[model samples]
Target: MVSKLKSANASAAGQITSRSPRQIAWRRFRRNKVGMVSAGISIVVLMLSLFAPVVCKILGINPDELNLDLIDSSGIPTLPNGGISWEHPLGLTPGIGRDLLANLLYGSRISFLVAFLTTGLAIFIGLIVGIVGGYFRGRIDDYLGRFTDFLLAFPAFFMIVALSEPMVARIQETGIAQGNGARVIFLIFFLSFFGWPGFSRLVRSQVLSLRERDFVTAAQAMGASRKRIIFKELMPNLWAPVIVVVSLSLPGYLAAEAVFSFLGIGIQPPATTWGILLDNARRFVTVYPNFFLITAGSLVLVVLAFNLVGDALRDALDPRSER
Candidate 1:
């Protein structure tokens, strides 16, 4: 009993202190070994991607520059084993003598940038439609709900594929954007245009319940402006889920970019993307299996890392979950 009392006293005096939610979340996240490892990998990849240009400058390599010497008469890379030489770190791309490491790094940067932009646009549209619909909960909600449902049921992927060529042409005709630039604008539009319904539904469901909370009710009783109550009272509480949703949504958009690029509909030529690499990989898969492996492996690694981090965030932010 005396020992127990002393231990409790020690904890109360030194070991125990009130932690903010952010601190508690970080503590819980650190306890998650898999999450920590994945986060480190993600941070490393993002950093490398962000500084790809500087790194390439230091290495004196242009990712898009074609080195005809590296290509043999047979159109296969001259290097015997995946191009790992003093000049080329990861290797020379099979038919194209562009540096593999350089392309990979640049690909990472562009792919993530597109994913981030698409996710942001989707989240913004979702937030607006969701909060308004949930708070009003009447004819207004019904109209908004139906619109989102229509988007959910629509064949967005097929539409994108079917319209890709003409869409790019149309955008180019309008002089808004051209070449792959136009394609990029079209791709971002198609993605975010159709991608928002799911998140909107998630937010609406959350807002529906959160609106009746004690704090919200107190705000209402205190004659807070509708706009203020919605933005201040409810929106602040929505951040946790919004963050988790955003984290989870990125990989999907990343894959989407890769898929469209592979199919010749995504960001156009001269762009170094994993999808473009994979699309090219099919031609040499039988002879140069390593080529396929590196591209596919990189994609798998980044996606898995993102998914694990998203799961960790979901767990860490759940108020009911045990530490």
Candidate 2:
């Protein structure tokens, strides 16, 4: 009877330990109502952006196609007269007569794409640099550390602003980045280039603490290859912090892309982005405040949603958090 009882207890313990770290983290995240709601909002925004064409069709408006009929003699979209209609839900651009809803959907596509792609690239580069540097401390670490410091010393935004116009112009002139596609790629590269160093530093710090842990030492003693230890052993342990960094950094990248667009260095005409929309709306802000309000409001909502989600993730994943 005692043997049977011991066996049952063992089985129960195994069942309790079956849950993976990811599953546990997810359970914790779901408990945070604010985070869960923000995540849902972010998902909805992404879907709307991804399916902008279909959304536009359902709404019966063309984002890029001109609607000169809607424009007045002064070239401003007919205001309150044009405001909040079934055909143009968010009203129309004052001077251009483009559907505000359609433009917003398309613009969201650019903003979200830039933020995610740049963050992905930065994470990839940072991971490689940090893992290698931290694993092989000494000369390799010194060289990489200096390079990262050098990058951090510069004002990243200023560098982007100064280089964007000339770099974009050259790419266009060379037929390298001709259309909106080229501009998007350029922005991705530009943002990723400036963004990686911070993450690299973060990863390097974490790696420094982890490299001396027992698992790493045990892996080394067992004749595991350096690459194997770094990728298989070390990488798994780094996921928690990496995820937190990625989440926190996304909003910053989104804001940067918007700033680039607003400054005329981002996606240009024929390509509707929130930043570009804001740039155009600014001219008619006095006469038609709706145009500016709609675009700015959308930007604010996305940024705020991302920030809230990130904060929630940080708290949820924090091992010390009681929640």
Candidate 3:
């Protein structure tokens, strides 16, 4: 009877162990109402941005093709001659007869793309620096830690702006980035270099704490090579903090991209961005407040959703969080 009971318990434990960490995370994440709600919002926004062509078709607007005939900057119609109608939902802008809905959708695409790409780049760079600094731990770690601090001390935006114009000109001269693709790639790289230090510092801090744990010590004792220990052992342990940080950093990166574009250094004309749309919309806010409200309001919602989700994940994954 005792032997049979022990066998049943082992079977139940084995079944429980079969579930992956991601599957477990999803289960916990779904139970949190705010996380689920914000996740739903994020998904909807991403879908809208991804299927922009369909949206443009339904809205009956060409995002890029402009109409020169219409009066450029008409405000919202209150009286018979106040100017806006159902045809122009958000009303017209200063000098461009472009569809506000279409431009907003197009800009969403750029903003989303920049966020996704830059986050990926930042994580990759951070992971490499972090793993190296943490695993080696000595003069190497000290040097890297100090250097990251030094980089962080600078005013990031001003530095990016100062670097951008010269870099873009240099790339154009090299005939490397004469077109849109090159320009986008350069922008991605530019953002990546400046962005990684923060993530690297975060990862390094996590690694320092994790490396002294019993599992890592055991792995080292088992004759595991440094590569195997770092990649197989340490990397797996780092995923929780990584996921939380990435989700939080995404919105910030998107906002930064918008700021860059607004300043005329990011995705230029013919390639609209949420920041650029807001920049153009600023002049007509007093006239047609809806123009600013819809575009800027949407930007705020997207950023807030990401931030809220990140906050929930951090709480859920916290060591002190109740099981």
Candidate 4:
């Protein structure tokens, strides 16, 4: 009997050392072809954005410093010397004469910042509203539900248009030193204001279902506080859905930024974003088609990567999977 008990203890110890939820999720993600490809794209893009300064240094180009000499001369959008130097393959812009590649890499930093901030802010606001509304299904829920409906009633683009002018004006008046930093913050705010409702609705639906689950009931029976149950137990269980939503939200946020810029409301002069780059290419698409192709291609890749990864995460993280 003692030997059997010892054997059982050893077995339990071995099981305890097995892969965790995160490890399992990672393994599953790696096994997925689309997920792996998406992850690769995400890593490359993030690295390019993060190390823009280093890349600029290695290329002997100041990302912010403009060279007017190359402006409008445009043979192939290459180097300052006008030869097909491998340094600036995309060529220099007309006004700034900055290396397109360098500007692209640098611009990604701001674009990524806006996308991430917008998604995070939306998620946070959604979580708060969702938890409160879902855990308590009464007057509070009704009020919040109605408020969410009101937010949803407006077309996202129209809402952004209406808000951008006043918000941008306020940021300009703040005197906190204008330029890239200010623009990024304001864009994030704009995206968040229009973006949060979708996430809130998602979370609310998930929480409404989760609140009735057995574990939740057990926690309630064990005298767990509503706060603890909602934040700790309930929220943690919603990780699968949250991961999927966040992954999807990122690309949507990026697209929104691009649209705003395309409409002349986003990243402005002296500060370049992928959207602004695309906007610039729009006028010259017939003349300089490469410009449009490169810019549009990059944006498409980013959006597609996010969507593929989000779908993969949803499948891999599902608790009911036949693991």
Which candidate tops lDDT?
1
RMSD of 4: 3.7
Task: Kindly provide the TM-score of model 2 when superposed on the true structure, using C-alpha atoms.
Answer: 0.92
Model 4, span 1-323: residue lDDT tens: 99999999999998886788888988887889978899789888889789999878887766676667555554334444332257666666544566777778887787888899989998899888988898898999999999999988888777777777777777878976466556677888767877788788888898899999999999999999998998788888777777898999999888888877778888786678888888888876776676677778888998999899898898789767753
The candidate 3 region of ten consecutive residues with least summed lDDT is: 75-84
Give the alpha carbon lDDT tens digit for every residue of 107-152 in model 3.
Answer: 8888888889989998999999988998899999999889888987
Candidate 3, residue 79: how far the Cα is off, in Å: 10
**Which regions of candidate 1 are displaced past 4 Å?**
1-15
Model with the higher lDDT, candidate 1 or 2 = 1
* lDDT, candidates in the order shown: 0.88, 0.86, 0.80, 0.80
- TM-score of every prediction relative to native: 0.94, 0.92, 0.86, 0.86
Question: What lDDT does model 1 reach?
Answer: 0.88
Q: List residue ranges in candidate 2 displaced over 4 A.
A: 1-18, 79-82
Query: Quick one: ranking by TM-score, best first?
Result: 1, 2, 4, 3
The top-ranked prediction according to TM-score is 1
Q: Pairs clashing in candidate 1?
A: none
**212-286 per-residue lDDT for model 1 (tens digits):** 899999999999999999889999989988999998999999989999989888876678798998898888889
